[model samples]
Target chain A: MFKGKKIIVFGDRDGVPGPAIAACMKAAGAEVVLTVTECFV
Target chain B: MYDPVIKACSHVLIHTPSFVRYGSKPSREIDDSTTPVLPAIETHLRSFEEAVEYPPNQVFIGNLHPDRLNGIEQPWYRHPVEDASRYGAYGEIMPEEEFLGLMKLADDFDLMWIEKESAPMIKKSLQAHPFWNNSDLGKIDAAVEMARIHDKIENQGSLPLYCHGRIVGCMHRHHEKDDALKAQVLMENLMAKASGALALTHLLKKSDIRADEIDLLLNCSEEAVGDRYNRGGGGLAKAIGEMCGCVSATGCDIKAFCVGPIYALVHAAGLVKSGLFNKVVVVGGGSMAKLGMKFKGHLAKGMPILEDVLGGLAFLVTGDDGESPSIRMDSIGKHDIGSGSSQQNIMESLVLKPLDRMGKKITDVDRYAVELQNPEVTVPAGSGNVPLTNYRMIGALAVLRREMNREGIDRFVLEHGMPGFSPTQGHIPAAVPFLGHAIDAIKRGEMNNAMFVARGSLFLGRMTQLSDGLSFLIEKNPGRKAPN
Candidate 1:
């Protein structure tokens, strides 16, 4: 139900559904942005 | 009148506690995809409902009866692991479905999915709660087709989320490598963060202090928030801070086995005194790894796994308002490398020396907060009442020092000691647990001074044979009598 909601995640890579969850949320219209993990911070 | 002291104390819960829950340790039946839901396990879990609602919880945060925990019979050997509310209080137990919804809200992506069957249940749960009134779930298209969910489970959704033996949801892996963010690790980390964040927000509300007022945040939970290169490095502080709406705040993680919160308190107090920050919060989340940490002993006695709840604490130490309790900065205790590891030596170094330097006696402090783990949770598992043991030790010390005769030890304990009420979440149950109650006592002038003492095993990391501890005193504000 996150339509139009802006969201940010800390760790979002393989093994963690963070990216997938973010991608799904984005597909559902939430504005997904930012990752604070090692490579992406 | 504003001394560097605690202004308020608050505690919150996630409620969806389980003794044998978590993704990392899956059973043979749940080890991989393609398995049907494990009905037996869920049934076993649900049977525990009765244990969680016991007299302790409601009065616990002191909602209804304040003396329930004090009145309950000791050595509740009737059961193992489960607290009295074996089934977790309805007020606290946020049913599995509801918890998934929370996990979703905290999720920035559509990576979380509940079966079409479970989605409605989650929705109903979310709609019923005040905490979810402003949620965006209704705005999102949440129900996932089983076929689609199955595909995700088979291909990318390797990390599964189970509720009541059903494939309710799955956490996916975004990488092809083995060392990447594993679904197992993700689930564990997310569970801790979500729970901790919820507790933190609840504390902010309980204290009626705006989150933005917090200048710093610290996550003393056992979870690590990092990536491959720095797998063990952490930043849960910043993540939880942002979630708590500490907009201008920046935070870092602190770890020292179980003594973290005490160390964090000393550091925060120093920060407030140093003029680097005005208001600081030291918060910790419960851990999944610690869930059912004592399952074997509990099960040996046919009791449900009791390590159900993930307990957490949040307290604010700001410029003392002269009326609130001030932290005694004059003689805080710290265990040095030379501090011997024996019980007597440790106690002397940790409890006595510091107080002596401050010209205080063992009996001077009105109350002492140490390992207050609930006896009910520990006794059934063969571990005796921890807090009482600590108090008895102190009483013994008092006797040796000629402060009290052996006969007076019991009286001293009865007057100064308290039953353990905290969950056995190691660090979570340490001295920090009594903070809320201590704040209440000081405000009512029932206690003039309370010393919080905590010890941690350095042997866990295999780096040192030494034990570590720190002690700090909080006392009734002397009004204009002192500047802390």
Candidate 2:
């Protein structure tokens, strides 16, 4: 469903991290330009 | 800058055939008049050799990896590991006598009393064990006379302790009339603590972390340790920590039936990430009440009882080392109160929802660790292959999500699923059993990521009709911080 999409992700250490979202998006044919996983707390 | 990684895990087992009669179902049947006594139980009890040689038990103690079970012949009990040792890479398989001595060592108020004749055997065994010394064995009191022990059992309500079908010791009642403080319950609680302490001690050794450095301890065993004033109001964590010399650690019990360990793991991770503790340890002891839970079925099938051992496990969670696999805190999935209780609904909530949030599909996870109850123990009881059932369900979900067609489900499962290898200790089998292997495999670069999923039946407590579940992912550490 994410085919041909350009995505940027901000992930949380306590929730979902950015690399995981990037992996998912990439699996769905998206181009992930940036990914960051932060501790929001 | 705080990230928690699983540093090490240790799995230990105690072969306690004598305790099988004390398990919930067996005791209930014993007390009831309608059902006949299980005639085949005593004859069917596996010996120490069989217990150590059993494939699943070997897997539980880390003598053999779970993947090795695939190549071994089915009806795994028939094909024993050649020259299996009492100790494994992760932990040891302790015999009943040493565990009895351990029960005495774990006892503070002199509740457990070993017969005078058997004292030397226990003392020598404990003395030779890798983890203990003479000073620790000093906690074992001089043996009680057979007359006094018989008195305690005959009229004082003490539970008899056995080894090799002999009366080796007895546990005295804590209170005269309180059922919660009775000898039987106390025995169960002590077994949990003693076995749990062994696992914790091993975890300290495996992780190269000192006992006092364990700043927090979590007791996730299913045993309830409390007095009559508050049955199940317990302090297993501190009890276990005290036995293991985790002097700086004080903690409490967490209960969610089979899902207790996973809940404790998440809590431990949170504690470490929040800087509440530098190192947190989660330990679960084997349930004496779960022993021989499926003995009747095994007996009916003319097979030896497979549920003869008590399983214990411990995991160390510390600030990320930039080498060990890091728990994906962001990818945690929980079963909500509103989530439907159907198989598909539960899978979607626990398996797919977290993956969806992470922008991944079912195929992305290298492996999925779920209920790992040994199929040999469960199959005869009509419970089916639990872990495989979970894998197929996830595969089915992939089909539903259009990740693959229906025919590809088997291929998906084969690539991502592992055979069930955990002992049938209720909480012991629920996904967490794979932690030790997961850490090793990821570090060895054999796999990228694995998801641990735990499901509990809330109805077992009779509080509600709802089912419960939780999941989290563990992947190879990226070894870099995210940009602010």
Reported per model, the fraction of native interface contacts reproduced equals 0.00, 0.00
Ten contiguous residues minimizing lDDT sum, candidate 1 chain B: B82-91
Q: Which candidate is the best by lDDT?
A: 2
TM-score per model over all chains: 0.81, 0.90
Prediction-by-prediction clash tally: 36, 3
TM-score of 1: 0.81
Off by over 4 Å in 2: A1-41, B33-39, B481-484
Could you tell me the lDDT of residue B46 within candidate 2? 89
**Which candidate number has the best DockQ?**
2
Q: Over the full model, what C-alpha lDDT does candidate 2 score relative to the true structure?
A: 0.84
Q: What is the lDDT of residue B164 in candidate 2?
A: 86
Instruction: Give per-model CA RMSD.
Output: 14.7, 11.0
Which digits, one per residue and each the tens of the lDDT, describe model 2 over residues B198-247?
89888888888889988889999989898888989979999999888889
Alpha carbon deviation, residue B176, candidate 2 (Å)? 1.7
- In order, the TM-score of chain B in each prediction is 0.87, 0.97
Docking class of 1: incorrect
Clashing pairs in 2: A15-B330, A16-B330, A24-B359
